[model samples]
Target: MRAILFVLLLLPALCFGQAAKQKDNPITIGTKQTFHSAILKENRTLWVYVPKSFTAGSKLRYPVMYLLDGEAFFTSMVGTVDYLSALGKMPEMIIVGIESTDRVRDLTPTHSPFWASGEPANDLKTSGGGPNFMAFLEKEVMPYIETRYQTETYRMLVGHSLGGLTALHALVNQPALFTSYVAIDPSVWWDNQLILKQAQKALPQKGSAGKSLFFATANTMNKGMDTVRVVQDNTQGNHNVRNSLLFRETLRKSKNLAWAWKFYPEDNHGSVPFPAQYDALRYFFNKYALDKDLNDSTITVDYIKNHYRAVSAMLQYPVLPAQGTVNSLGYISLGKKQYAKAYQFFKMNLENYPTVGNLHDSMGDYYVKIGDKKKAMEAFRKALSLEEVAETRKKLKELEAGR
Candidate 1:
């Protein structure tokens, strides 16, 4: 009898839990959205991941990251951004992973009959459609994402293999399309180093200037050979890495762009994307680690403002101080009896979030800490006017009665 009653009692709760999950909680990282591209004449799939802080009514905007090979690496990229942004190592981003339909036709710049082994192949007849694919991305995919989401002007491109080749093509020809590019183990030997020559011409002429790039090379050399020996060897299997190094030299000519490269001997072509992308993110946002600089005694309001201003300038996007972070900093200062610093932080939060009742309440706490009853009353009144809270009402009443 008790077991029957227990099951009956739990049935509603279990059903409610299931219904809630089905309604509000998504089981996957993000929704699979489709857009029909007139440029490519097909429906393209986008696996997009927005930050946890994203909400329908929120005014916060974020940079966008367009990743190639969505089906293969979307989850990993989402996890990377989530972890790094949570730690203040980088800004939260909207990751748009593009799933490939006809990769060879879309990624390769010039159609080639020869394989990577310098031998003729029959399957690559659809090669060299990358220009149209790029148009699909720029015209269709980008406009779709930007119009649907609240995004900053800053955008980043990430690709591997043939996708990486497309990224370099964009960097050389359409440099202004994205703010940063991460090309991992790029197939630079494609179409007889077509992009390599373009880069050689464009890079010296201020191509990719004022932009950020991080390209990685994997260990694609022959057996019993190191980098130097492999570069010296002109064998068919070594064309990719050799041309990659050649592109690296070309990248050095462009003093205007911020670029970094690493050769991964431990990781081969198939196994380098995860670690390479992780490192690429670090290279892209190296100066975004605020925890290293923030401490109880050393950090000031002016320094925090300057740090975000630098980030804004570097990314060419406006970023404001996070309200929660500043609030915590204010309380931290208050705990340390640094009244002036506490007041500055609280005031900054109020300025950033003027309509947030909690911020006005925090300001009331700050005024009370400094024993300024008049200002404290004003703050409590403002907080109460925004939203009625029992604690704020009590504080206002106590101040009004001169207690």
Candidate 2:
């Protein structure tokens, strides 16, 4: 039954691969999916990036990060996740970039025919669609992704500029929608500081939905001005920086939320997202890396188990030991002629990943080492039934011939 569940989990990857072959060797970083929205009455395009390490039929589930302004930042975000997760700085997570159809209409929370600098403009007619956009996310987009993907309950929201305003809007309005928020260069100056005022009041209240937040503002001020001077400037042209500083001050009363803020003296609005995204991910998963080496003979199974339990607690999800890590330990133990240690490692891996056919094949190798022909044949057969590995079949035939 567990093996069947494992195959079911791998089925999406296998099917995705076969369908992708219909394309003629195209270079791709993420897959574009269609999301039909009932609230918005439109079909939206969604960009999804699943880590390559996760496509191998493993049962490992990942937290999902919903990125706003995906059309601009999707590729860079994928590279950041790939680089950090490879070095064990953070866990590999699924990234879903929400591509926008009507940028200003979807991201802005209120309607005003004026710019943040308070200049009147005629192009703001389609504003105030944030409520519908939020509805589309919570009622349609999120449910679609959650139902189809192997995701944990912990979710992160990321955005910049107008998209950043929407990120804070979600936190202020629908606090439980995402577990954390990354609002880089957010336009709290929108609607004449509507969201900024609401956040100031709501963010300080007890049991506020925003449990975690990372706020960042770029150096959009005058060349000589720093964050302190910009806040006191009160010039109409200094609206964005001023609003950001005011919002940053909200953290003083927001002791209930785990939060951080930064002022990038070097990066402007166009460049701050890159550094802020990197820092925000590091902050979220600061304790994800294991302290001890799993391959060391001195470490026991109990330590590995406890380490991942701590990881699960930090992530607020049920994270299990990765099949690859445990398998490496098993193979290393086997190389040292430590059969008992090898057996323990293999058992620990198989217990965590029952649906993995590769683990069953490894177990057959261990049974053969112990000179148990009957058990070896049984393990090989079971391994073959779950996954058709050539080595498992070859060993099974040899055991039968010996009989």
Best candidate (score: lDDT): 1
Query: Against the hidden reference, what TM-scores do the models get?
Result: 0.87, 0.83
Q: What alpha-carbon RMSD in Å does predicted model 2 have with respect to the real structure?
A: 10.6
Q: Tell me how far the alpha carbon of residue 383 in candidate 2 is from the true structure, in angstroms, after superposition.
A: 2.6
- Segments in model 2 whose C-alpha atoms lie over 4 Å from true places: 1-24, 51-60, 86-88, 208-210, 235-239, 295-298, 336-339, 367-377, 391-403
Model 1 RMSD in angstroms: 4.3
lDDT of 2 by residue, 1-403 (tens): 9999999999999999989887658667889999678799889999999887676656667889999888788999999998998887788889999998887899988887788777787787788898888888888888898887889898999999989999998888788889999999898888888887888888788575336888988888876767778878977766678888888788777747888888888898999999999999988888787776766678667777898899888778877776677787888888788989889989998887777788888888888888888887887888888889887788889899994
- Identify the leading candidate in terms of TM-score: 1
Report the poorest 10 consecutive residues by lDDT, candidate 1: 288-297
For each candidate, the alpha-carbon lDDT, in order, equals 0.88, 0.84
Q: Give stretches of model 1 more than 4 Å off.
A: 1-26, 372-403
Residue pairs in steric clash, candidate 2?
A: none
Q: Provide the global lDDT of candidate 2 against the true structure.
A: 0.84
Residue lDDT tens for model 1, 1-403? 9999999999999999999888995567787998788999889899999888886677889999999999999999999989998988889999999999989899988889777676787888898898899898888899999999999999999999988988888888889999999999998878777788888888888645569999999988888777787778878777677888888899889858899989998999999999998999999899876654445578889878998898888778888877777898899999889999999999998888898888999999999999999999999989998889998899889889988
